[model samples]
Target chain A: MSSTTVDDRSTTVTPPKTRGAGRLKDGRQRSPVAMVVMLLLVLLWITPTLGLLVTSFRTRDAAATSGWWEALWAGGWTTTNYSRVIEQADLGTAFLNGILVAVPATIIPIMFAAFAAYAFTFMDFKGKDVLFIVIVAVMVVPIQAAFQPLLDVLGPRGLGISGQYLAVWLLHTGFGMPLCIYILRNYMSSLPFSIVESARIDGCSNFQIFWKLIAPMSMPAIAAFATLQFLWVWNDLLIAKLFLTNDNTTVIVKLQQLLGTQGQGAELLTAGAFISIVLPMIVFFVLQNFLVRGMTSGAVKG
Target chain B: MTYSHSTPPVGGETAVDESDPRVDDASPEATVPSDYGLQPVKLLIGVLGVAATLWVMMNLFLAFAYHPEWFFDSKILMGTLGLVVGVGGAAVLFWFINVAIEALPRKLEHGLVPYAFLIPGFSLMALTLFYPTIQSIHYSFANRDSTEYVGLQNYRELFSEGAFWSAVLNNVLWIAIVPAVTVALGVVVAVLADKLSASSEKWAKSFIFMPMAISFVAASAIWLTTIYAYQPPGAAQTGALNAIVQQFGGTPQSWLSIDTARLNSLLLMVILVWLQTGFAMVLLSSAIKGVPEDTIEAARIDGASEWQIFWQVIIPQILGTIITVFITVVILVLKVFDIVYVLTNGRDNTNVIANMFFNEMFARGQAGRATAIVVILLIAVIPILIFQVKQFREQEATR
Candidate 1:
């Protein structure tokens, strides 16, 4: 929360008898050059996104005929691409499916993880160290490795739970639980143990203790994980392709479908891409403070 | 026992003694321990009671079933059983353990509570992850069809194949180029954005971070439309780059098709760099922000130039974060598939290990070779994993 501003005039200042005299001389000399360089850097970073935005607005012919910068002078833009994308792609259904999968996927793991994290941090039991390590080690295994095995389980021979929302939801929860537990456990362990002991002595059951005490305290971490998991599931394409079929496809999958083999009608792609990006942007903005807090909190000392 | 003191009204404040046996005791005989045998006997009875109830319910359904076919079908039986037993059973067991943990005496609770919570997660992880990983290793040594024993043959073929070597080399190029470029660009952008004024800073950071939100498939689609062949001659190019070229009176060219000695493949790498730059930027930006302002001011006061301050003061302080970002990017680049799969379908020298695995498994129907590729990729990642673990420990110690 603290902002540390460097002295701008430090370059022109010589060492003085006092710290105040030294800071005063440096504060005056360095501000202008810093401002100019910062402005240039900002411009460089903004150019590409500006180009993408401008190209999305202009007609295909005008876009191809001139640089995105030229669109400023040409002054012709339309929403035809957006309309075409909406009409051609099943954007609505895909977006709904994305929400259906992402919301539960985010919530379930956080729920399971919080309880497990509490137990790991506060409770003592046999084989606790080995169990915790096993969970942590699962993080190293790539999702691709599990794809076949998961399909085998979901397919006809095993659970026979193919092509349903539950399949993808379970897969996401399973994959997400390890890191969620790891972060939540670390955070929960750092809380004051005296409070927990007092609650136990007051005859509070474990579930009651978790629901009333631990959950309220870990809201910041839970919110942080929710933002991350939501973004990941929303942008995910492979798992959706693998598990969800036809009407169950997510927005990202729908965007992929919009682009033909040669990407011929793909000027529509820019609009579709933007549509898919909108929700995540909103989520990030809404939870921006918690997101920053969680990152710093959960960077896990490592 | 004959005479008692007047009792306080209900809800009146009363101090309870810490070692009061008569009030706190659960046993009929307050001085004696309850029979320990009764505990396990009750647990056994509860478990059997639930199992018996499930059995009777299943039989009754079968006996008077409207959907008799469902009961007869093995698949249905197995599915129902798996759901009830696998997921539901786990939930039940978790609940039982949670209850038992609370019942433990205060002195023993600390030692038993964590294990009770961990049992379910560990069991599921073992069943789904650890078991499969071991299965994969076993599968690696088997024959292509996995029908017969063929020890070392797959490993031999893996080492000798030209395509395998090409995939390895491409992976090397990817590891070298993607992470290095992404980190460098990310650092530059992060530093620049940090220097910007408030309004411009938001706009710049948002622009750089935009690609991070796009799916790999969507981003690839965007690039494919923009850079690949979409020219219709007199109609003008829809791709922004080729359009710019045409405006300058140069002929429009398919940038992705330019196989001027693997330049096309490198162009594919560019899309990845663009997509990942935001990730690197965000991490490094925070790292840069964490640099102590006093250090920079002190350097400037000591006659250090702007370049000198950046190189000496800022970079050194953030080197650990830079390494973290670098390793993350490397892992991503190693698993690079979606872009190559979507953009060019691994043509024009763009194929990496992952795409090759997918091609062999799904496209070519060579499960043996596909599994082989996966095993090789896993092995390659091991050294990186070890390094990451070491870094993690070091960081933990400092914290």
Candidate 2:
């Protein structure tokens, strides 16, 4: 939304120069204490995930007998846990279902919101301001408000789409629309309107202007929302749990199921946890820049 | 002012006047601008055509949505069919509506076309969010299955339950602690990371931010097995905290079961803090980076220490970002369910309102009370909603 300001702000960041004896030209000392504290905090943050990652490779006996650190020091690791978790937990199907649910859920809303955003940004319509405000206000409404009723609406007696992937897809698209429209509209508004004006002057219709002019220009914001939505849907458990039955459960749900109540099958859980997180972790690192931009621009997810 | 295209503007004079220089010889349809007498009929026909197309689209969509078992019994096939019909069909709908709006009388087309683009998204919102939200509130007043009206009985029952109050208190603790602590640590990480060499900063931030990508269920699993795991006094401790405790000649304690004074609840809050601190850092880091370097330079020239400059100079500049990050996290915390759901499922008095709602509705089948909890949650969020609208207006002002 604040794309221009973000660009301006980022460009103004001071380029790093080599620090000799921890001093910068700006009179701010680069303290070694800060670096050490930063490193320690970083270690503290990453250790939990690292421990599980290590344990995921260890055998059940070794994991029960020793800490993950011991396995790290020794050379007792195997790929068996992953394979067993996949086979026993049926995480393979869940992983596929995660993809099946996430892709359309991401694209459908973005497409619809992009068109709506174009109208909100470039066209004059009655009640546009009020409608835009309503969309923004929807950003804060907890999805819980729509939870039970959406179930009723989509259940067999209503639309008969419950337990199917279409149910969650529709729910995700609906829940995602506000932020999508908000982000894309903010971005489209920031775009230079002269191009749109010229296209309109050349007798281009609103549809033509949206497709030929605004859509290409809004790619950065679109990509940002797309990445954010995909991740949110993939990591989501609440909506998926409430909507999809066991037959179409996503990976996150399967991981929870595999954990069991008393934390039975800890071996499988340690491995299954890694399996569930791997795709999202990959997506996060690969799209880290877009993720940051999307977050800063008010892509809040719960 | 121009009609160089095919169709004539409805209920208007001939579009291509010989006196006008914009007359087109390029397209043959432009020569038929003499059809002005029947323009209203064309407009009627266009509207009816678009309406019928919309009806057919809805029927087709409902057919696909309602009967997946009929579509060869594979969700993949039904999903593909639904996606095509849903997305592709909407595109076609918008095209048809815009085409119909082209024959909208005179300047009405100008005003109507935007609505054509807006119909699908708003319709979806109306169905999925707005209507259901009202239905939820209505069901709060109704009986369990929403079959009969029961007034405020659900509210009274929920307010009287100790478990509900415990959930409320735990939620209060979470709201009071998580957002503030996450933002504080985030600012600290952002400032500390900013001082390092660029490569070191990237690696450090990556470690801190890495938790954000994983699901809360996975996060809970990571912590439950790695950090919160416990064993008997003599058995070797596998969990990190227990192992460290045993190394100090102390008994290994079950961290999550220590609910005395809500310690376990506080421990569960740690997982959310760990997961969310990275989000806060990324936002605040950019805010920190956005602060003009010369301001810090000027603060230093005035003999202020780095701490003083950070407090007096940098904090003021990034206050907007801090508030933004703070409110966002607060909203997230208000809806906190997964960590609690996966870790303890509200056992040992760790219940939050969201988990309470989940158990009440799905686990216990108390739809009335569940909707009541949601209504209460909605009430709690109303203030934040108003504040956010104000905040958004301020941001829009700056824009």
Candidate 3:
């Protein structure tokens, strides 16, 4: 009833106004002050990243002698900056480890959340609302709380899952669940009631309706969810560093390790950090559309 | 947060039925499965599911228990096989149980089905989140090894110490400064960027939003180069801030280590503000676009200037989004671990709650004190969480 009331109220205010004026975007106003202000903001925002990017390619002497902007005009670049980190700094191994941890970490949450979402949407289960509410609120539980107990439980004492890929994967799944299930259920439940009603009227079982009817329909949401989760797990350093404590874990964690032990030769950090950064940059561009879906869908990945 | 699409992209996500294609009147898959019969078949399905689930969970357990050797001690091999078997095996397990639950007799199916679907997810949260969370609380009240019950001594000790108080003070400074400044910058940038010509607007926003996608550790490295890389006297300053400082005949004080002016904590806050502003921008930019067209036009028609229109019309409409962005950043600020750990390891009086938690547990082996820090972090998070949940529910009701 609230939904219907909201819908009815919106229709009354839209049509007459739209008929008189074109959409707001069609009307354009440009001001030089606004443009300059925007440019300044953009510059301020991107200065650190741009400076780092240029420094990543510069040789040690060039980087040390001048700032990145100055070095750009002063001319000196090397391909070895990239390869040296990969070959010598063990970034290549770290990169592979990132992929290894990220792939399964990404998949586990999406699948578990999907099946559970199907139940939440289509099945007539008691305590469903309460359960969903509790789980959704679990999104805010500082996973920092989980670390010590998790370490103790899994730390060769209880389950012996610490430092393994499985440890990270399972932890990621748990961390990802509240938001993933919330997004997925919201997406799935929006399917036309007519299709589901017809399926039920024809006596299709709940699982049949979920698999044959709901799963395919939910692919876009799944893809959107997966892309965000993959990036979250990939770029995450804290959780991976804790769980995958071994030398070969994630590129970002390894990059931090590089920063720690190899504090000298600061130019190496620029290249090593970029090596860790490049893949996520690609993912951001490739799955660009889903990110909008991800944001409004819920769970802002920080 | 980095990925705000080119268009003024918001609002379509909340309303999901907008483009639903109508199904044909009679679909073929809907035609079968009227009768609930074959008791033997049902029993077989249930038994198979239970056995297979145990097998799958067992494999997962053994895989972790004997890791580095489970797949012949190779990372690549372990990664590949773990994905295949984990995914394939989980799929089979989920499918079997889903079927087994559906085939149960009418009397118990309704009660059991929800729990069946819920068991894996619930148990995971219980195992990984709730169980650990409870243990953390218990450990907070216990001694270093957690073998001795120290009661409130850890909390008393934590409450009394100046180092702990400084961490709290720095965190307070962070939450106070970072959210307000980041939100103001985001709002201003969003409004200004919204005024840009279509061709370059996205690029301008993308440039600002770039840091959101990178890891904080990498951001630390970048910021170290940009602002914090300190050199001894007579050394050429490579850091941008120091280079500029030297240009004006000032010194390149180690910006990260100096507490003379509380510069180090403020510098750390700037890194957060830098990382978070883009997220705030993208979300607030979309929320700006979502402001009704007629409202701003009406303000302009009423002889309002650009600034008046922005403040009067746009800000009111998107205040909810600003609050949402603010709370999100607050939560992030509370969990501020990676940056502090990577850059200074909370040295020079730059510690926050999360960094303190790590310092106590892993670095110092003080479980009770560590859990207290964690509990402190959780207490800080709860009010903001309640606000977020209320926001979500209100949004849902409108849908």
Among these predictions, the greatest DockQ belongs to 2
Q: Write the per-residue lDDT of candidate 2 for residues A30-129, one digit (tens) a residue.
A: 7788878997898899899999999999987888888888885765788898998889888888998898899889888987898999888888778887
Relative to the unseen true structure, what is the C-alpha lDDT of residue A267 in candidate 1, on a scale of 0 to 100? Answer: 62
Question: For model 2, how many clashes?
Answer: 0
Q: In model 1, which regions exceed 4 Å deviation? A: A4-80, A123-136, A293-302, B1-96, B104-110, B142-150, B198-203, B226-235, B247-250
Alpha-carbon TM-score of each model against the true structure? 0.79, 0.91, 0.89
lDDT of 3: 0.77
Residues B97-166, candidate 1, lDDT per residue (tens digit)?
Answer: 5555534443344455565566556554555566656666666677654566677777788788877787
Residue B349 displacement in candidate 2 (angstroms): 1.1
Q: Which stretches of candidate 2 lie over 4 Å from their true place?
A: A1-29, A73-75, A261-263, B1-71
Q: Which ten residues in a row have the lowest lDDT in candidate 2 chain A?
A: A1-10
Candidate 1 A-chain TM-score: 0.85
lDDT of 3 at B30: 20
Candidate 1 CAPRI-style tier: incorrect
lDDT of 2 by residue, B176-262 (tens): 999999999999999998887565778899889988898999999999999999888878888999999999999999888789999
On a 0 to 1 TM-score scale, where does candidate 3 land against the true structure? 0.89
DockQ of each: 0.23, 0.51, 0.35
Q: What's the number of clashes in each of the models?
A: 12, 0, 0
lDDT of candidate 3 over B244-330, digit per residue (tens):
788788877788888866789899889988988888888898888888889988998999998898888889999988888888788
